[model samples]
Target: MSDLYIGLMSGTSLDGVDGVLVDFSSVQPRVLSHATQGFDDRFRAELLQLNTSGPDELHRAALAANELARVYALVVKRLLETTGTQPAQVRAVGAHGQTVRHRPQQFDGTGYTLQLNQPGLLAELCGMDVVADFRSRDVAAGGQGAPLVPPFHQALFGQLPGVTAVLNIGGISNLSLLNASGAGSLIGFDCGPGNALMDAWSQTHTRQAFDAEGRWAAAGTVHAGLLQSLLSEPFLALPAPKSTGRDLFNGPWLQAHLQSFAHVSAQDVQATLTELTAQACADSLLKQAPDCKRLIVCGGGALNTHLMSRLRALLPGCDVASSAVHGLPPLQVEATAFAWLARQCLERQTGSVQSVTGARGARILGAIYPA
Candidate 1:
């Protein structure tokens, strides 16, 4: 056979879930079908609320996870229908639940990360073996339990010459420095905020979900002082093996920084947020992988024209482009990676990179929920 797998991802942005049906029969995996489902305003707000503490959180999270599983199941249905594939045909469905809080290696030494998901529900709904919770294993092993796409990037794009880096700009931004020359040949870490901050800012001002194509940000001017203030975040200066989410860079974090820049216009603040994401990614690459030549940008941020332009301006020497040019579209990259991860789990192979997540060693990530 044919090695068919389905991958589902609802990332930090909290915007929606992306699912992909991929065939990995040959050496090169191909996306046979793709589907997406966006969370309504109310549901999105609830998910964001669960990011912090609230009344009956345990109960609320469970219900939310069930609802999320339903959404994933819907996407799975679409993918299978589009490709005329059966549940039994797919080896497994890799589901990355919504990450509400990510604070690995914090309190009590071995900190925890949470990705709310009902793998069993998903398995039952989709009638396929489901692989979920692909992070806790790494955290338990003294790793960050994040930025899990580096190894996938290496496997997919390692053929490129020179020091190639893949920048995945989701709700949070991360870098995967692949095929390096000397020590630290493969490095990956959470750089900084991606569209999460910008999306929040836009919603606050314009009541829009996100700044489409970054037009709102492009129309405004970057406030140098605010940009510098955002850059001063200590997390950005930290070494690799670090990951972050709404736990640190959430609304409170942005509001705290804006307390001093109260007079700043909303549009200017939006511009500054965009620049912050671009700067953080650029700074990380410069510091960690200075020799990086080709930078493949993926995730939702790849579609932001203004952000992409800023990255190009910030990193003059490096060639920046979306993963689409490399045959994988922006949204499909992560989903495909999860499909690959599902294959890894089924084969009893290592799915995470020790160097990337700072895990003790390579581990077969994810828990399988059999149908």
Candidate 2:
């Protein structure tokens, strides 16, 4: 028997929500339907504000949670209508929620990561079981609770008989190194900024949300010196099994790196930032998984032609291509992974790799909320 599952994701980009319908059975999983819903400008601004703003923003987060739950429900409804699936037929929905703040190693005793999602509201509205709060458990187990896509990557792309590196360039970049020998041989970690830096720079200068196709970056010249300075960030040198988010890649972090180049053209800075991402990613690959033969790119950054070209140049001698080459769209991989994860939860199986997360042992992720 096949099980239908909906996976909802809203990453650090604050761009939108991705809802995917997946059909899973004992054999394999397939994408049944998909939808992308954009967040309004006001809500986006509020979410960014909540990232840095204090206690008062909690109320705003609550309101945004409700609004996002509504959006998730709407997307699921559309997905079900198009796929001819019903709430009763669908097994569950995996909601990633909105990550507001992630301080994995806070100075305070209460190290925490916060994702603003009202699962009760989502379950109530969608009339389906919801599995969420996917991160905290890993953290409690002494893991970074991120780059959670490695196990799914292993499940999907572990057929070949060599080392395969799956790179996800979301708001922050991450990598999953899968050894075809077996499922437990996977290793993963966050590899610094992806579109987050470029998007932030683009918005600050051109008043645009993102640099389309990285055209703005292509138009400008890369400042080698600036690129060197940006790459010098300590986070780049951090060891594996680590994860980072907007908290470490936000406005203030950019400001600290912006020196006498305040007068530099915004496009030029964007170009340098783009190079920063590609260079850091390549550097990490060379250092950590030097034996990798194939690099499969996914997430929003895969669509940036300029970035793709940079990666090819930097990672010469390796086959660098989009996940599409292997049957997954760059944009939908994460959402699709969540669908697979929800299936794991239902089966009482471990969804995260201990090597990737540094967990003492494999653990079944996500808390379930029934309709």
Task: Give the 10-residue window scoring lowest on summed lDDT in candidate 1.
Answer: 178-187
Report the C-alpha lDDT of model 2 over 1-371, residue by residue, as the tens digit.
45888888889888888889987764556788889988888888888888887777878899988988998888899899998887899999999999988976466633678898989999999899999988888777777788789999988888766889999998999998888345448889999999988988888888988999899999999987778888889989989878899988988888887875677777789999999999989988888877677999998999999999999999887899999998878888999888888888988999887788786778898999999
Off by over 4 Å in 2: 108-110, 180-184
**TM-score winner:** 1
Off by over 4 Å in 1: 182-184
Worst-scoring 10-residue span by lDDT in model 2 = 103-112
Give lDDT tens digits, candidate 1, residues 1-371: 55999999999899999999998987778999999999999899999999999999999999999999999999999998998899889889999899988888888989999999999999889899999999999999999998899999988988787889999999999999987755436888999898999999899999999999999999999999988999999999998888899899999999999999999999999999999999999999999878787999999999999999999999999999999999999999999999898889889999998888998998999999999
Q: Against the unseen true structure, what C-alpha lDDT does each candidate score?
A: 0.92, 0.87
